[model samples]
Target: MRVEQGFQPTPYTEGNPFTTDPVLPNLLKRLLPRDVHEEVYGDLERFGLKVLTTLHDLTSKTSEPRVVQYDQWGRRIDDLQTSEGWRGLKAQMQEEGVIGIPFERKYGEFSRVYGFMKQFIAIGDSDVISCPFAMTDGTSRVLELVGSPAVKRDIFPRLTSRDPSLAFTAGQWMTERPGGSDVSQTETIARPVSNASSPYGPVYRIDGFKWFSSATDSDIAVALARTGPPESGSRGLSLFLIPLRRPLIRPVDAPRPPALTNNIKIHRLKNKFGTKILPTAELSLEGAEGYLLGEVNQGVKFITPVLNITRIHSALTSVGSIRKCLAIATAYSSVRAISGGRQLLKDNVLHVAELARAHLTYRALTHFVFGVVLLLGKTECKVATDDEVLRLRLLTPAVKAFAADKASGVMEECMTMLGGQGYMEESRIGTVLKDAMVEKIWEGTTTVLSLDMVRAAAKPGVLHASASTISNMHQWANTIVSSCPADLVHRLAERLATLRICVTEVISAYTNPSTPLLSRPTLALFAYTTSALYLLEHAIWAHESGEATANTDIEVFRRWIDEGGLLPALQDVRRVKTAGADRTKMDAEIVYGNTSTTQVVDDLPISARL
Candidate 1:
């Protein structure tokens, strides 16, 4: 709502105060389930051992520096050398729709690497553009439908079947010539063939040139095409499960022609700013034969499932990039001595405080992201109920918007702390910073997410108890502000107070059905503001508690709460809540034309009553 040219994106984080709630703690613990960790770690290890190792041999061994990830202008990678398979992957990621890493053919021999590739498909996309994780998750659901036990058996067919030469990867759908972000204007057309010889009676023929396709040379593509006429918009669009080897089904006996079937051809790749290894491509599909995956005119809907996961991955990618930045910033502050004789962070106690706080801020977001993933696991391909559907729609924007905002600040602060060296090539935060700059713009910009937040805000009582639980959270923050050192806490209290104002007003605004729809945007901002402070304030509360201060990245929860000038700043949030409640009561009174009620119970925000 307020833009400041002087604005510096700093993460003034705080701890959560609601650990007392058995449900939250249990949920959080479960959210970062040990099983999930084992799975993730397992996937990463297998990926490297199987896919990435082979990938290194294929690309760099083949002598392609361009595929190794260069600067926006073809300059050079600063430091923190690129990861395995990252270079070649980046080359095709920005332009081509699909890519295959660790290309090999064990066909029926080696299942280890082949087994790993499928997992890589799920996770590699996690850090992708537009949050490919969400897209994958969505696709995984469809896979379950089309990709059932029967299909998995038909495709992979063996658990230990490792084919060093058998390759499968997650292909990306990036370029939309009508415009990348503007999917409604797509010119790609998929027409059902008449009297076709394929098993499905007829194959849908696709014709269109895609620009900026990423993740090239892979098993399959989650492609978008217009099944109807051009003017039909998103509704006319449909999703097709276009496999690399067409004519050949059941995933065995490796086809001779591995090239993308029919009319698919690669154009030039674009050299861009960051995300280098992703492999940007310009592709032409002339009468490409593809199977229609979902209902006609509802392709976007089918893709929406994976799109959700993709957004979260995109958020996590930003998180990872920022993690790299924080590493440099803290390091620089620790080593670089400043005017006060000690390092910049030590020169002023305040600086040390901020440094610790930023560290925690990152951890807090990361933990929350993992929590979202757990939630995603529970969510299915199709939202069977309205509440579930609404939750997905609302949560998607919040994840994207909030993650991007924090990413920019995290990078900026990390760079600022680094000072001179930060600007240099060696610091490396600059690369992460520049890499992150585009995140907020692509995959639904910050402002775009804010609007989505507003839309989510319109759904009152969805969370049921989320708002109240969050409110109780503010009270915990108030305790920290009350107990912490005098001067700093006072300033923090003021900001907290405003945060409270923003929160309560939002809860009241949305809960009060009598309130007009025109005011929802402001209401939505209040909701987002609440979500921000809820985490921040809770972080502060956790630090003050000390008994269960997070030990590792989990400790970020503790570190954030200790950050200077944020504890008391959260006090304002409570005030906002109070005002919001009052506003709600007032609106109800006016709507019913009665001045008698002191509190509006039935119409209260879902979180309140719950």
Candidate 2:
């Protein structure tokens, strides 16, 4: 047999995603007791190995889920057939209490941090099964928030159950053809079902279509449906908990049905560009029975909890994916020979720099993501200060958007480092990149989330709290620099000052008429500035604790600041207006592509000129 010449695969590392690197665990040790860290780290290590197997199955393409819309008898069944690998993942997640940790209260206030960290570790190897887990976690949290006692009593245990057979995953069915992120345009309608009742409360018959239903195999869903007139917009909507399948177990003697008994009809499965193993469906709900959750017409407010949770999940997934890709690239670099027959790891200076930057990106994003997670933990435990809650609210979109934006770039760069081998489907690098692309699009696109950050910032007291937090970070940096190597201190100090100035400028720009284009840059500035501050804190921690890798951590921070890592592209107002005008014209020209900007500009008042 002719073997492929000059190819060597990197051996898999067998251990914990967290414990192997003491950075994350060490960072947590600053807050938790040593014993607590050890216990949490050990638990993650054991389960991480199993999760690694799931990753292997996913990368090897052995767990692609398929939709079977009809039975062999040509009757509608609308069943989802997933692979054994997928089943194993679901079972392991449930058994491991992956979705239940925060609610379990075993770890008390730190539980949310623990839960989210476990998710962050598991996501790299989770085959994106974390999708359903996110929804399940969010759904459970929403139920708790809305005070749906009966629903909680009946569904909460199953949502958090350790038994796979009993555990139920949930879907967030909010997207529709008319509204993707603007949930105010929701078209799904909920009509009162006369004399009907559910575990939650009064029953409603749901009717309409959901355009993008993720985790379609879930047992139940939390959805938004209009209970008021169509003109009521988001205010008219009501939240509902709809079981995909009736809860009653069918008797063995019961007659077999030709089609699924539930009213949810799977119209088609989306042929997605990535996440091929998870089934996502476009569904029609024709008279599907549901129980109203929360007060009528407060669906948006009720579902806010779920959105926050899912957004955090999305951020974690981005970081996790980037981490895994970087790991693969690092491993391959050690073994693969590059240009001039040199070991890629040893002889390539630029390659080494790229790798170093990737590592830097990973370290920085870890802090940013986990900072939010820690805040989330505090808020959930009702121990968070007002400032912390405000920070969490402001940072959620920033972290999610920023991580996703950087994560895709990280994967692409890592894949490029793999060269020819990276393009191969079997290399799994492409798959990682493909899957990561959706992250920025889902949860919310960067532009959408940037605008969200602006809205969040505009809220009363948010900007002031944010300013205080950044100031506190600056003080922390100053303290760290007081003791660290002298060569780096001045530069770090300068960068910190730059960060403060940039933040202040952006804040001012938010209200300035001439700087109406500050939305995107301001959000980017917020994310990058905060992330740098977090990186500085971690660096200080590593140094103060005398970790062996403290110098390496310090250098990453040094490079980040020296390389203009904290500086954002701040355009002058004149240029911004010019660009705005150009864009407005271009947008007018393009019904499809390019049209006439003259018509648009001609109609505008002088004061309203682009």
What TM-score against the true fold does each predicted structure earn? 0.62, 0.88
**Cα misplacement distance, residue 406 of candidate 2 (Å):** 1.0
Whole-model lDDT values for every prediction: 0.50, 0.76
- Which candidate number has the best lDDT? 2
* Consecutive 10-residue window with the lowest summed lDDT within model 2: 468-477
RMSD of 2: 5.3
How far residue 191's Cα lies from its native spot in candidate 2, in Å, is 1.0
Candidate 1 yields a Cα-based lDDT of: 0.50
Off by over 4 Å in 2: 4-16, 21-23, 54-61, 248-259, 339-344, 464-491, 511-516, 570-583, 586-610
Candidate 2 structure quality by residue, lDDT tens digits, 1-610: 3465566455434355666643566667765567677778777777667666765564354467777888799988887777877777788778888888889977777787778877777765667888999999999898887746776676888899888777789999999999898888998989998877665788898989999999888888999999989888999999998888764234435543321566888898889999887889899998988888889999989999999989999898999888778777777777766665656563578888888878888888888898888888889989887767877898899999989988988888888887877787766777777877788988889899878887886666666335335432333334544555555465467765665565565555554534446577667767777777677777777776888777877776666666635653444423453465566566555755543466677688988894
Residue pairs with backbone overlap in model 2: 589-595
